[model samples]
Target chain A: MKGRAEVRVMLKDTVSDPQGETLQRSLVSKGYDVSRVRAGKFLQLELTGYSREDIVARLEEICSDILSNPVIEDYEYDLEEVLE
Target chain B: MKGRAEVRVMLKDTVSDPQGETLQRSLVSKGYDVSRVRAGKFLQLELTGYSREDIVARLEEICSDILSNPVIEDYEYDLEEVLE
Candidate 1:
């Protein structure tokens, strides 16, 4: 079955997030009155020809191997069946 | 009250996502048997001194005004109370 998967990849706690820091700075510069801005990445995939279990397993691998850098990032995901 | 807010930002349909395309190519090259990779940005904020409703409204403004470019991107978010 065809399906959609959403993978959210984020910097691990020990990693330095320059991008997030820069964004926070910008927001503060604009006088938004906010703090503690952490940023990450989100990926949505259109996956095909796999059962739900297969898709989940494959996606988990893809997330760890390709979607994120293990030393610096972590990931989570959601999957749903989709119409072809 | 202190709370956490998650914001997901993505390119609009009309925008070209070179990063996503490049990632897709890299995944394909690695023989992942996958297709259609769309990527976006996610942000987690540690916000303070606001009611749930206030936080939601402020975050909506922050997302539209700073976190995303309306001409080319869109965003969504979830907010939850957190311990200080």
Candidate 2:
């Protein structure tokens, strides 16, 4: 079976986001009153040769272990079956 | 009044994604048969002193102008009213 996964990985609150800071400054210069902004990574994956359970388990493992830095980031995901 | 916006910026198909390539390599080493993957940026913004229309318009501008490189990336966004 084929499967798809969408993962969102965000920096932990304790981590500083320089990209967000730069963006905030840019928006301020553009006259948009943004109090704050945080940036993160979003991943979309296409998988093959795995059952739903395996897909879930493997994606959970991959999202936590490979996609994000556990010490400074956290991840969330959604999965669905897809056609070949 | 306050508002929130979520923006997703993705590399166009024409552009190569090195991060996704690296992640694919790592997953292959881990034995997950991922045929392909793409990575993007996610942004959450907190805004004040804007009407819903203004929020949308400004975010559309920012997402295109500052958050993403229009030559290689495209962006999408959602906006919602929020309590102070």
Candidate 3:
């Protein structure tokens, strides 16, 4: 079976986001009414597996150990079966 | 009125994503069954506006002119009203 995953990796609330802050400042300077901005990462993955459970288990490990920094980032994913 | 927007900015299919390629290589080396990976940016925005229409109009501009490089990237967003 084949699967597709859409993952979002974001900094934890306790972590300071300097990039987001800078962007907010820039946007404000340009006269936009934006009050806050947060920047994060989005990843789309295509995987091959024998079963849905197999893929989910692997995805959990991959998201935690490789896709996000456990100390400062949190990751979430949506997985769906792919016809191909 | 207050609003929030979740925005995704992705590279066009024609543009190569080196970062994603590198990550895919690293994951494969670790024995993952991943086939393809594409990476992009996610942004969360908070804004103040008079109405949903007002916010939507500004969001469209912000996404295209500021958040994404029109030549190589494309952006999409979802907007929702928030209670203050």
Candidate 4:
């Protein structure tokens, strides 16, 4: 069974997100009431030929390996069953 | 009462994610089975003085206004209640 899945990787608040901070500065310059800004990335995959566990394992590896900095970035996800 | 929240934003698969693609290439160079890699961003907010609806409203505004491109990127999130 094939399905759609979403993965989220973000910076630990303690870590300074230069990209996010840069965004904040830009948004402020653009005239918005955004006092705080933290940037992050989200991933959605239409995984096939793999069980949820398998996909999770692959995704966790992805995060730990490169998708996120386990040292500073934290990650989480959700698996949405989608139509084939 | 206030709570903790997480936001996920990513590139629409239709749109090419250069940053993600770059990361994928790097990961492959490091020796990983990452056949298909889609990069994304995640944001965690410890919102206060706001209700779920209020926070969601703000979050949606953030996504539409600056977080995710209402044009291509689709976003979603989960609210985790934590001890204050």
lDDT of 3 by residue, A1-84 (tens): 899999999999889999999999999999899999999999999988889999999999999999999999999899999996
Runs in model 3 lying further than 4 Å from the true structure? none
Q: Report per-prediction Cα RMSD to one decimal.
A: 1.7, 1.6, 0.9, 4.3
DockQ of 3: 0.88
Chain B TM-score for the candidates in order? 0.90, 0.90, 0.95, 0.77
lDDT of 2 by residue, A40-62 (tens): 99888988764788888788878
lDDT of 4 by residue, A1-84 (tens): 455556777788799888877876776676543455576767655554366677567657766775667898787777665565
What lDDT tens digits, residue by residue, belong to model 1 across residues A1-84?
A: 887888899999788888888988887787655778888998888776558888887788888887889988999998989976
Clashes in predicted model 1? 0
Q: How far is candidate 2 from the true structure (C-alpha RMSD, Å)?
A: 1.6
lDDT of 2: 0.85
Give the 10-residue window scoring lowest on summed lDDT in candidate 4 chain B.
Answer: B31-40
TM-score of chain B of 4: 0.77
Best by lDDT: 3
Which portions of model 2 miss their true places by more than 4 Å?
A: none
- TM-score, cand. 1: 0.90
- Docking quality of model 3: it rates as high
TM-scores for every predicted model? 0.90, 0.91, 0.97, 0.62
